[model samples]
Target: MSHSRRSILGAALGLPAAVAVGTVATATPAAAAAVDATAWTNLELETGITPQPGATPQVRTVTILGTTFLQARGAITCNLAADTKIGTLPAAMTPPTWYVRATSPRNNSQGINACRFEVNTAGSVTIYGATSGNPITWVQFDSVQTIWR
Candidate 1:
């Protein structure tokens, strides 16, 4: 019968207590190897992204290897359903990856906000989270640092 280490130890030592996992100090060889193998290299470029003129201000850029990431660190505020250019991309989102995604909207009280974002061939980013109400100012837009290769 295959007995757990705990059962064997309990029977031997007569200690009727449950022991939490990771009792041993050193890591197992397989665990160590798995950790070493699954290393990530998500790089951030030193260059900064310049924001266009509007309420939708403050855009940042970070590059990793050949891939480029355009990110908005803070809440990107947009003015009244206007098409505010968020920031420029490294290259145009091609036909295959033409559509970019936006996640985690900061505010969704009144209605669902729309991420009207577009990447042009000349590497221009035009995006805004706008509401449907009159004089609708969208607040707190969250995007996951859209990447371009």
Candidate 2:
């Protein structure tokens, strides 16, 4: 006997009737395993900020798919004339977790700027000056837990 397309698909899937069930199958251990957030608890930036004339900010690696998350704070630039702002990190950054920022110096005086970072995986990140206008100072403060999933 020959099976129709419906029968073939059903047989292949090992399901009952053609009536589609709204419920989806749960992911197996191999398919979806829980990520450990604690592994990235102590992740930190390896490099410091390097000021330049028009250099772009850097994105350091952090973590992903974990239960715990990390929050980091640091300083970027010391250019008093221009206003410095931190930029968002890359999407799905794994190994080299990092972030970037831009500096706008209003004057020549030195200015101290600060920033914070949060990671959801066990990873490391770095923050560096993006612009070449003036070399910005960097200072990492601390990493704290924000949420656990």
Q: Identify the leading candidate in terms of TM-score.
A: 1
Show the lowest summed lDDT stretch of 10 residues, model 2. Answer: 100-109
lDDT of 2 by residue, 1-149 (tens): 32133554566578643433432354457534444332212222234333333333333323344322333333343332223333333445443233222222222313534333333234323333324555434433333223322
**Residue 19's C-alpha lDDT in candidate 1?**
39
lDDT of all predictions, in order shown? 0.42, 0.34
RMSD of candidate 2 to the truth, in angstroms, is 15.2
Candidate 2 has a TM-score of 0.25
For model 1 the local lDDT of residue 59 reads: 43
Among the numbered candidates, top lDDT falls to 1
Least well predicted 10-residue stretch by lDDT in candidate 1: 36-45
User: Which whole-number lDDT from 0 to 100 does residue 129 have in model 1?
Assistant: 56
Candidate 1: clashing pairs of residues:
45-62, 45-63
